[model samples]
Target chain A: MLTKRIIPCLDIKDGRTVKGVNFADLRDAGDPIELGARYASQGADELVYLDITATQQDRRTFSALVREIARHLDIPFTVGGGISSINDVAPLLEAGADKVSINSAAVRNPQLIDELAREFGSQMVVLAIDARKSGNQWQVFTNGGTQPTEKKLFSWAKEGQERGAGEILFTSMDHDGMKQGFAIDPIQKLSRLLNIPVIASGGAGRQEDFLSVFKLGEADAALAAGIFHFGQLSLPTLKQYLSKNGVIVR
Target chain B: MKTVIIKYQGGNVQSVAFALERLGASATVTDDADTIRTADRVIFPGVGEAGSTMKYLRERKLDQLIPSLEQPVLGICLGMQLMCRFSEENNTRCMGIFDVDVVKFPAKPLKVPHMGWNSLHNTKDWIGDSLDGKFAYFVHSFFAPLNPCTVAEVTYGRPFSAALRTNNFFAVQFHPEKSGDSGMRILKAFLDQSA
Candidate 1:
């Protein structure tokens, strides 16, 4: 049986990790490379570096930071944000990133997914969906969850899978940074509907939340930010707890 | 001494070469057989369809030359699969250096590509202290089953050969070059063996 993965997401801006309170009030945490190594040593199954800054200056810094992290870390890392072309993914992957996650570019041109999947196998391409609840349904958001789209969560996810996304990283805006728990109902439905692995992100406050996503939500992986960056919950301790609760974690 | 990484229209050789440079070894990327045969060690790393890759190798006469080498040869991922007798991927015939067949994991709830780090158990003595019971990085849908040639084993849906060795020919289903410290140790060990 495949073990569930625990990931720590680091939002990179100007080559430094910037931690925010509910995606606002950003503060510099540390160097992206150092933070990545710390998380990997702490037993993070994977690391996600989202380039939060959209400027040209920030992009170069982010690329440099990605090269630094890729040189040091051994685990799989996913780099995202501001990636608009197939050419954009090449340098990041060549720099040592195992996978590249596309958000705004992918939603705009779904054909990019097929082109990327064809050039660099589906396993190397990840589709990140930033979703927020709209009345009874979840709506996909673009541009780091600022702009909204009419595409429903389930339909967009299905489209992404059909377009050859190897995995889906679903982040719920409502539960993000709240520390309440994961939005399990919608995630579980998506997981059941999609054959590819689904990584549940947002609202992971405690060890039980991780277990809940794995057991109840049936997510292939769980990704948290605030808890890990602030040193509130460590990965090894969490993995030990999950193992005790009959969750197979490696 | 510089290492020659054989690049024959395959996968992940540039990354593997970059990894070699990080380990203080100068690496040259080329498909020229002379360049590969003259290097201190040759790394054949690839990621793609097995049948197409073997076809490419045969077209270049690399299929006939790889097994006849006297120097240390390391194959990673699909490169390792191509070293076996046959593969279930595209019903491809492979190099007969190791008498094993690569088969896909049976249909299950588990993902087709067994991606991520898995422990390699039941290691052979030749593996030395460099690689024994240590986890290595693997990403592949098809695997080579265990036999007398198996040097290490890892379990997914079932136990499979993670590493196989037969004289100068060494192949690992996992990517040692990308597997961090444990993987680096394996590369160092291979270097030591060749030296």
Candidate 2:
């Protein structure tokens, strides 16, 4: 059986790992290479590095960090953040990232998704959508959730799958950093609506949240940053918790 | 022992090389027929479209050179698909080294690119049955159904060939290079065949 994936997201800024609550109030997590190696040792199914670095100069550092992280990790990992074009993706993959995630830039130029999927098979491309529920509908947000777009969550995700995204990583902005639980309703709806794998992000406070997301939300994988980063939950223990609760994890 | 990784557009060569390095063996990433043919073991790693990758292989005549060689050759992911008779992906014909057809996973409400870690069963040969029931990372949409050559099996939607072997050629649908320690042991086993 294909076990549900447990991912620890490392938010990288200026070459250091940090986690924010609701995408603000950043805190030092540790060195990415060390943290990544730690998670890999503890049984993280996959790792994702969101390069929240703002300037282009720091971009080189992020690639270097990715290379170092790749050297240390045997498990697969995805790299993203500010990746808008095929050019930006080539370097990260060259540096040994297994996959690349595209967010705001993809929304800005939706054609980028098609180009990436065509050039490098859809399996190598992941489309991340950050959205918030407004008036009973999830609205797509961009620029680190500070700006809103015309795309609705479900429709845009369906379009992404049609456009050749290998997987859909849906992060709920409203539920992000809440530590309450995952946004199960929309996640379940998205899982049913798409043929591709859905990775649920945001709102993981306890180990039970991981189980609920996989069991209730039907998420193929659940990703969290703060809970894992702050030691609020360790991946091995969480996997044990899920396994005992009838959720298969790896 | 010398190892050569076939240099092609699709193969995720760097990680494979890194894994070999982890095992204390170094590999050369190359497209030259001589370099690949002369090596003790050749690795055909791939992760690109079938039609285009086949075209690249044919244009460079790797399609012919691959099957003619006698040394142990390992194919990963798309590399494994291309070693088959044909693929549903882009309707492209493959190298025919393995007597199997690569078909896309059925649209049965299950995910297409069945991503994440999955366990392997009924393992033998270079894959090592000791590693049976061990988890390996997988990310693919197309798979080869069970056949006489299958040495290992993994079920996702249905039982499929996770690993196949015949004489000097071996292939695996999963990315063993990125599948943690369990995968490392598989690579080590493949390398051990160099004896």
Candidate 3:
């Protein structure tokens, strides 16, 4: 009876939630705590907080923001972006993040995934991959998709899972922001390939797109930013749509 | 009521503390036997390997202290697994509170880490029928099978004990703190028992 998850992502910059989050109720809409609480109230399965702020001072601010969000919301949230070392993960988790997603760091040193999974549990480590398709094969990209590595998407995913990653957050760089739909072929491939739950990220435009990702893509979860951020889509409405379509959603 | 979260080396203590805080209760994370014994309620929270965790507990004499305590006790995830008589995880022996064996999920078709939101049905009335069919978050590879101590059952590959109750001891394999409103209700209900 495991239900598919629907997650709304919040990108944080300068201690303020930037990017696609466009909430009108809170006078200070930048406050991630309010946004997270609203999403939980509307029945979001989980929330993802991506800290894009880079700097020693800003990382501290992001950690503090994570504490605020964890304190305010009852649902589980994963913290990602700019997480590099063991030190970076400890504070966010201590501040009450259920899981920490490592992207570029994991790509840089695959050992970091093992180390974090050892320090915390495998269930606490999420390996986030930003992949771009190249000539019949999808390549792993790092540094926010600016740098492409020689590592193939499937191999790196298998490696991450073998290294004790509890879950895989696979985001297709080519389909990202395009709103065309999720990278179904790659997602379905990964879903069939890996035992861990695959969270399909990037390019989720409408409610039906989530259905496609869940039914066709076979993704355990579907994450979106713009559509949910701009109030174009709501978690309740999307979940209801999926439920009506014979998909079990919670 | 005095509440104390039994602290071992490995566990997600902060989130559990925050969950209680939201329910208007404050708790201290401590390993001191006296603190645990004195508290009106004790929550043993964990997320780690079985053999090593049991070793840590025995080294600190918590293995002896935990079972001896006379108060309402609730175990979460690994905590609940450790309270069982035995665990297939590292072949570690556990406290005999639940009289069950924690075994790993079967390979193939069913994932090892049965991680996600799953609802509990066929629940005993002790935890109430309110949580019946309500989704509770779960993230664990090993599970305690359906037994006499089981208060509620959940189906992944098959029916497993999602929540168990015996005397004053209440335990759940799910993380209520991260399970939204339905999870909060479960926590609140446990608190009501102590009250």
Predicted model with the maximum DockQ? 2
Docking class for candidate 2: high
Model 3 lDDT per residue over B52-124, tens place: 9999999989999888877889999999999999999899999988889999998689766898899999887
Go through the candidates in order and give each one's DockQ: 0.40, 0.81, 0.80
Of 1 and 2, the candidate ranking higher by lDDT: 2
What would you estimate as the lDDT of candidate 3? 0.88
List residue ranges in candidate 2 displaced over 4 A.
Answer: none
Provide C-alpha RMSD values for all models, in order. 2.5, 1.0, 2.7
Candidate 1 residue A140 C-alpha distance from true site, Å: 1.4
What is the per-residue lDDT of model 2 for residues A1-250, given as tens digits with 9 covering 90 to 100? Answer: 9999998999998888999999999999999989998999999999999999846787788888888888888999999999978989888888889999999999999999999999888988999999999998999999999999999999999999999999999999989999999999999999999999999999999998988999999999999999999898998899999999998776
TM-score of each: 0.91, 0.98, 0.96
lDDT for predicted candidate 1 compared with the true structure: 0.83
Worst 10 residues of 3 chain B by lDDT: B122-131
Steric clash pairs (candidate 3):
none
Ranking of models by TM-score: 2, 3, 1
User: How good is model 2 by TM-score?
Assistant: 0.98
> Model 1 over residues A63-169: C-alpha lDDT tens digits?
77777776677677899989988878877776767788998898889999999887777778889998999899999999878899878889999998888888899
| Per-residue lDDT over B164-185 for candidate 1, one digit per residue giving the tens place of the 0 to 100 score | 8888888888888767677777
- Top candidate, metric lDDT: 2
